[model samples]
Target: MTIKKFQGRTESEASEKAKKELGENCVIMNVKEIKPKGFLSAFKSSTFEVTAAVEEKEKSFDPSTAFKNMPKAKSVNVVANEKIEIPSFNTSPVKDRVITPAEPKADSAISMFSRTKEKEEKELEQKISNLQSRIDDEIIKKEIEAEDKAEEQKSSENRQPTKLKRKNENFEFIKTLYEVLIENEVDEKYVNQIMDEMEKVNWGGNNVDTILSAVYQKMILKFGQPKGIDISKKPSIVFFIGPTGVGKTTTIAKIASKYKIEKGKKVAFLAADTYRIAAAEQLRTYANILDSPMKIVYSPEELNGAIDEVKGYDLVLVDTAGLSHKNETQRADVKNLIDSVDEKYNKAVYLVISATTKYKDLLEITDTYKEISDYNLVFTKLDETSCYGNLLNIKLHTGAALSYVTTGQNVPDDIEVFDTQKIVKQLLGGR
Candidate 1:
């Protein structure tokens, strides 16, 4: 893997630089705002610094060739070592036996009868000999088969360690990776999915780098690409909604700052979070700082009116009251506010969540909002937690596009477009 860093006036620019230099396959491993340093730094804007990585391609290893040069076991020949002997029958007695002429006719008849009996006995003896020979042949065949089997077993025993060693190595590496993911709080279900997917890959060897690269790529693909605010078309209204104390207000401020200050887009703020006086004031303060218009509306009708006021603006970010997911009334209020938006306006909803939230609560929170609207996800307080499994968990569960993530309380500076590569690397225990 090759890792390097690039800087630009914006994150996308820096990312593009990385991709251009490292090839399009390069992934952004980390992203940070590099604040201008020195005495006159306040006059200069901060630039984005991104760490990017790309796997170095190498010749593929063929597993079939691992034992291609092994010595072959010699063939066994059982019949070459043993000799067989056959017993000969004496026929002199029959030839030498004389027929007496005591009574010419009677002696001749008696001799004929004796000769017939001798012939019958000889035939019976010949049959026994043939049967014995057949038995010996069968015995030799069985002995030969047994020897061949023994040789094959010995050869297998000799080769077993090499095969077993490779298997054990692969198993150990996978186990370690599994443990690392679990330790980082990745859900067992997702861990199993990742490992199962790995099993399907035709990785030629158990090299740590190869396996890690495969897993990293799988996770990146799982995360897909993150979609942030779209300003390609003017007059876009974005609504921020989530549970209480999830930093929704602060997140809105960060995004508003990015657009108004960095991108120079005409930004407006619509504060529907009338339940909390401080939330409204917080947004107002940000609006004042950004020199953008701010409005406070208590009803869906008022929100639509506020939207109309910002029709000429490039972007309007709406902040909704954070309420318990269990409260159906509050949920309905949010749903109504979103539904009240005029179909003529292009609107988007964002579900802001705290990274430190428990996985179970995250699930419940995401499930609740899912009933209200099809919104994108924006995670906050990422600096407070080391385990980012919930990020992946919620993303997978909600199947929502991840937008921005806030790392601290610093407006604009603490927030950035969700870097899937960074989160995936952290999940895999990378720095």
Candidate 2:
């Protein structure tokens, strides 16, 4: 008998392979399932191995008779029932071993087939369990991602502003008010600050007229009233200082005429401006017209002596030289000259600024003169420019008490004490 083993993934496949290799007459000796071991256990699958066999029958021959009937000329010989031996040329001795096939155990094929079926069922169950877990994980992940996306979208929608009812009624009103103020030369920063305050308070009940009325009231509060002159000190020394072309001389003349002619107070003039040729002569003309005593001082010592001579007068008005704040030497000279005034005299310093001057220049002049004197403000040339924002701008920045505003070139007639309501009305586009 010749035996061979056949292997396949299953018992049916193994049995088919055994029949194909061993022919139709082959008998199946055994069927077994072999499971992989060691490192190959994870990768190699369990396989069914079937042991099969085929019978080979031996043939008997009358050797003695065949040898006797052979031809004499032929070299071949056949020996009958008397044992015959064959001779070999090689002299090496060798031992021979026999390998026997094991007999099939009772009902082992049926038991192995049953074990393979059980293993297949277990593998199917495991695969189904893994697939179910993966599906569950994917579903949970998708749900969480969807929820997060929805929350993020909702948060973004809440942060963005929605459309307002009545098409943002207050927006156009506030915009128009802002434009009008800016066109009239109000500082953009000031306008924006005011607007921000209004928005904070939610003022004016959705009407432009009401809003403007509230704004005008706010302006009155910010631009305060003028400070009055102090009458307690005898020979109150009033000094005028500022930039050129701002009418410092003319402003002093207005105050002098008001005190001397209208109020019937004794007033004297001291001219300390030697830089300008006509400055002293101009004041002398005003002094002659008002019939007030006028003196020209060449130095700080003369200025002190001039103050002494005017001691008996009710007021002493000192007119200073108009020097540009850009002139370092002249500014320092003016500062030093004013510093020489005696403490015995009551002094009031006044800075005269032009309303027609640029806001930037006005601020510079105010800052420079601050080093020379502590003073109140007086704005000139109010009649020269339609834009009066410069007056408010300077007052807002300098924090100086405004004493007077000169409307024109006329001495007493053009000058008026700083009136807050009148200026605020002009700023609001009123009379």
Candidate 3:
């Protein structure tokens, strides 16, 4: 038996050379970079690390007889054998794990060869090292064991699909909207009736604005008209509350504009939307447009103080924060603010709604906001929507009377005193 080493310009080249020298069956056992042998090696020289490896020959032969029976293939070249006696092999140690020897008579010869090969420490190390290199688990450097690696590989190959996080988040969002609507006690009649109307459209997803708009529409349609504004009532402090960006500020401007010019009534505005700088700026701009007085109120105490001070004015509008009904903490805080104002002055609560919000969201927004606002309805953004059904729906369901309808951002031009027929015409797809 003999072990041989081969090298070439590259690993593939070495592999080819090994195959040419030994046979295609030759397996690589070990590979390493050897220092280049020429003057050019000094600058940046490199050589292909290679291993031309084979399990040495081990077979018994009636030396002369085996040679006579050898195949006459062009790949094989055999010389007539002189005399040689092959030995019997003991294979008990590696019985379970070893690969089958190439030939039956070679079995005994292979055992003897392996024993002799093991005795040479450097050669044995090289063969074992080559075997280890071919094992194909590059991650062993991280201290991961073979069993864990095999398990990880298996798991990766057969991964299972789970629900998408985005879809889960959307479902959760929709669920929350419904919860807020329920919390508002938005009249079970209104919810069922709005759902019936919404069934006409597709509620297949969780679109918050669209859902909120629909609910708001239902409430307005059912109960939006001013059952009665008591002109005789004292210190009418109208507090507007609902979801953020539903046009609370704009609605306040509309109401203030109407009274200041149309009725020739004195109007003063208290801006409590100081949560955002831009929000305050927006109201201030409205104040400038209408040429009305606007006071920035940070708390309900300031609000009452403003109410006390604006006693000569015929109407006082308090602009509250645009709150999310889904946020309980914020909703409760708003509730406290509304209670504070009412504790001192007579609070005329108005729920400002947008026509673009969804039915479910409207229910939630209504339910969440009604805790702070409970007098009547003021709808905004009429010109931006095609669905008037929600307005009809909310009014018919919520039992809150309509106070005003806002068509656009124009202070005087965009607003309309609650006209049920005009709104109904618009709801029915009229111009």
**Which portions of model 3 show Cα errors greater than 4 Å?**
1-231, 342-344, 426-431
lDDT agreement with native, every candidate: 0.82, 0.76, 0.64
Using lDDT as the measure, which candidate wins? 1
True-structure RMSD, every candidate: 39.2, 17.6, 23.1
**Superior candidate under lDDT, 2 versus 3:** 2
True lDDT of residue 341, candidate 3: 70
lDDT string, candidate 1, 1-431, tens digits: 65667899999999999999889999999999999754446799999998887776643344343234222323211121111111112322211122232333645644454455556656776887787677767867988999999999999998888777776787788898899889888899999999999987744345667888999999998887899988766689999999998999899888888888888899999999888899899899999998999999899988778888889999999999999999999999999999999898888999999999999999999998999999999999999999988888888888999999999998879998999989998998888
Worst 10 residues of 1 by lDDT: 77-86
lDDT (10s digit) by residue, model 2, range 47-143: 9988887764432334543444333523312212111112212233321111221212433553344455557667876887777677667867988
lDDT by residue (89-181, candidate 3, tens digit) is 233221112222333354675444544543564576677677656453454553478778889978766542222443455446545644544
Q: Give all TM-scores, in the order shown.
A: 0.63, 0.59, 0.47
The CA lDDT at 36 in model 1 is 75
Q: Rank all candidate structures by their TM-score, best first, as comma-separated numbers.
A: 1, 2, 3
Query: Which runs in model 2 stand beyond 4 Å of their true positions?
Result: 1-170, 204-210
